[model samples]
Target chain A: MSNTDLEDDLRGTFDRAAASVPMATDLTGRATTDARRAQRRTWMISAAAAVAVASIAAATFGLSGGRSTPVQLPVAGGNAPASTSAVETEPSVETVSGTWRPVQMAGLKALSAERPEDPVLVFRPDGTWTGSDGCNGLQGTYNIGQRGEFTAKAGMQRLIGCDNVPHTGVLQSAKRIAVDASTLEFYGADGRELARYARAR
Target chain B: MEFEEYVSARGQDLVRLGFTVSGDYQRAEDLAQIALMQAFRSWRKVRKADDPHLYVRRILVNAYLSMTRRRSFTESPSAEIDPPHPVPDPATDIVNSDDLWRALAELSARERVVLVLRYYQDLDDRTIADMLGIKPSSVRSTASRALATLRKARQSHHVS
Candidate 1:
């Protein structure tokens, strides 16, 4: 027989053979659900990995300090001295080293007044930090004293012009740092609150 | 088009194509699902393509080849003979349905794949070559060799 005739015969045979295979009724729904599940699984794995890395860095850099040593702080009205015991009870900078979103800024609000984009600050356990202030990228190294005092020395700042916010000033003037649960507070050298940020989950 | 709409429309055709390629419903479903999931993941890019269906078909073919490669390394040798094909009904227009299917099954995976794409899907040599990542000349030779094998199988069946 000719090749065309043979091909026709094979096509007929293939059709009949394939006809016996039943159609999958809910294949679309199953596939859609499976795809969504796979996407969720991927997101969950990525989030877990981020948390794991943050935790590992926190541990490696001694970001989490034991509460055995309590630091003293003078009271306002010459009353009993306030102790860091209360602050140490919760997760402070030592336990919270990750990306944080600015919730409130005190001194440098004018720069972020027009368009208040949530400024992101990332604290690395290696005494390094990097983030964006809705305008320019900020990168620098930081030092945390035993009393949870944070001192940051600016390293590099991009001079991109943006009308939203300029976080360079706050980040540069930040001297004291405190963490309460998911909230983080940055203080200037004058002991006034510079910026308050919430941990980005 | 939305990914869900695409899946709803072309999903069955893909499953059928998978069935034709694998010759097993379960494996076909797996291959279709895997390809569809991959398509869904890259829907933004895939939907913008000139032919989304063709793009998905390429993914299905790749997935099937990958699955077969993995199966080859993992599956243990079986000494038992394969089950006999069902007896063909004389009333059927196709006289040797069982023998044909059995013959097709006996061919190597690549040979069967080329035959199915050419005859069943009615795809051209260039399209088949593009899908299988082979040259058009290779497709012609493979189809020629596959047809020769089928003819040999038919003759052997007649003698037996």
Candidate 2:
């Protein structure tokens, strides 16, 4: 066949394929929701950066003898006083360095990831984590306190709109974490079980 | 135009373009939504572009390319096209369309992308090259090779 014939065939194929797509349901709403989430995440990251900058400025000012008295900055969560000593004690905990797949979330066996894809979380030993929230990629920093008191700050993420995976929500609210050879579970601030995950083989 | 207005008017077309390029309906929707969401986030700059539609299309295409690259190398194109499509009737135009679809699937991503941008989107070689971040000569060569493969597939289908 001539190139013209091939080109016509190409156009026809695309037109038919495109026609097969049903009208997207509530695309505007979905996009708007995703945009809002992205904006919120961006604001959170900016606020964290600003706080870091302020801490640095405070440290620099104190070192330059600009103040007669030492400044006592509040620790994270602002519930405890900041440590003044240069040395710190290490928390005794096993590393949660592996990939885990959600088995249950918030008392619901059926997960948001069931429709499009399954969510997976990978925690590295270096206090960093990355995974897919079924659709969009997510990355964040995590810290495990002395008694498995877990805190996570979600970092930058792909702004792609997807089904609301409970994994991210569970992680953000997780105050305690437990892990074994085969399973991982997150607990809320009130000690309520939030989610459970199985180590991916 | 306002971002919402733009999405209302051209969203379906963008999704269609995405489907044509990705060959997956759900993924096409996601790509279109993501592109639209991104455009919404920076609607001012997007609206100021020479062609806002093309700008969004570029984002959609780039997302698809990046996604495929991140996928496991063992993945198969046939696996990605998992949704069951209707059997092609020999007497209807869909028979040729189905044959062409399979042929398109057999082509590499870059080759298929070039053909879709060139024939489906009616873009020129230079523009296609610019969007794909390849030399124009490479685009021409890839298109030529892909066309030859499609012709062969068509001839073989006719023979059978």
Candidate 3:
């Protein structure tokens, strides 16, 4: 038989077979739930790593006679103080590493308006950070200096641009980092708020 | 379009494509679920592409290929002995659709994938190549080889 005839025959057979397959009604719900669960799993792993790193830092500081300061721990369902000064007293490593989802971006509210999935930032204890601003994936190295000072080396990022989202500025200009309860803040060198995020569930 | 809207629009079509690739309804649903989940996680980037459906299709193809590879490795020995069944004569039943499907199932996974993308999905060689991450020339050669295998199977069945 000719090639065209064989191709036609296969197509006809496949069409007939596929017609009998039932449509799954709950696909959207299941996929959405699974995606959220996967995101949560990633957040949990990062949070766990943050906890481990915080423990080690605390132990080292205790052995070295570090200055004592009251650090506000993350409390479930508790409101973070509106004042940034109250939160940055003594930022622990636990406050530095973990998954954070962007909730607000100063002067970029339009970018956050329509997106249901927030951009995520994940800081690792190994001085590396990875994130996505709901568009491009970002990775870089970070350093925490004395007196709540933070600096991040500009790292490689994908160039895919999303509408209205200034992912580059938010990720690159992140000169200062602060954590208070579930709230995490990124600031520019000028001390202006670049972006704000909440601990991801 | 929003991620939920995209899912509502193309979810069923993805499932159908999965069915074509896997040749099983339940496996198709599982594969579609996995592909859609991945798409959802990266929807921000995926939706910005020239063809979001193509991205999802690539995910589906990759998942199917990986699953088949893993299954090939972990496949357990079959205990039941198969009874001899008569092969249908292609001379008499020239258009026997069941024989064509059985023959398709007998092809290698890659061959079946090429044939399904070419014949069933009605995709061009370039598109199939992009989906499978292969060269267009490789797509043509794979499809040609798959067709030859199917033809040989049909002819052998007729002889028996």
Per-candidate TM equals 0.54, 0.58, 0.57
Cα lDDT tens digits, model 1, A1-201, are 577766888998777666666677776677778878966764454345334433433344344352222223322233433322234323233555788877765423354444434567888754467877776777765555545555555655667666544344555555555665577765444344555677796
Cα lDDT of model 2 by residue, A115-195, tens digit: 455679888764568888777888876667655666666866766666646566667766566666776766554444556
| iRMS (Å) per candidate | 3.0, 1.7, 3.3
Task: Give me the displacement of residue A193 in model 2, in angstroms.
Answer: 43
Query: What TM-score does each prediction get for chain A alone?
Result: 0.50, 0.51, 0.51
lDDT of 1 by residue, B1-160 (tens): 9987897788888887787777777777888898898777557767988989988988887777766766353322211112443555543445565566767777777888889889888889999998888999999999999999888888887799
B1-160: candidate 2 lDDT, tens digit per residue: 9888888889998888778877877778888998888777667767988999888888788777866776453323421222344664443566777788888888887888888899888999998887877899999999999999999999999999
Pairs in steric clash, model 2: none
Off by over 4 Å in 1: A51-201, B72-89, B92-95
User: Is candidate 1 or 3 superior in DockQ?
Assistant: 3
Best model number under DockQ? 2
Q: What digit string (tens of lDDT, one per residue) describes model 3 on residues B1-160?
A: 7878988898888888787777777778988899999888667667988989888888888888877776354322211112223654533333466677777777777788888888878889999998887899999998888899999988897799
Lowest lDDT block of 10, candidate 3 chain B: B75-84
TM-score for candidate 1, please give it: 0.54
Indicate whether candidate 2 or candidate 3 has the larger lDDT: 2
* Cα shift from native, residue A177, model 3 (Å): 14
- If you superpose only chain B onto the true chain B, what TM-score does each candidate give? 0.85, 0.86, 0.83
Off by over 4 Å in 2: A65-201, B72-92
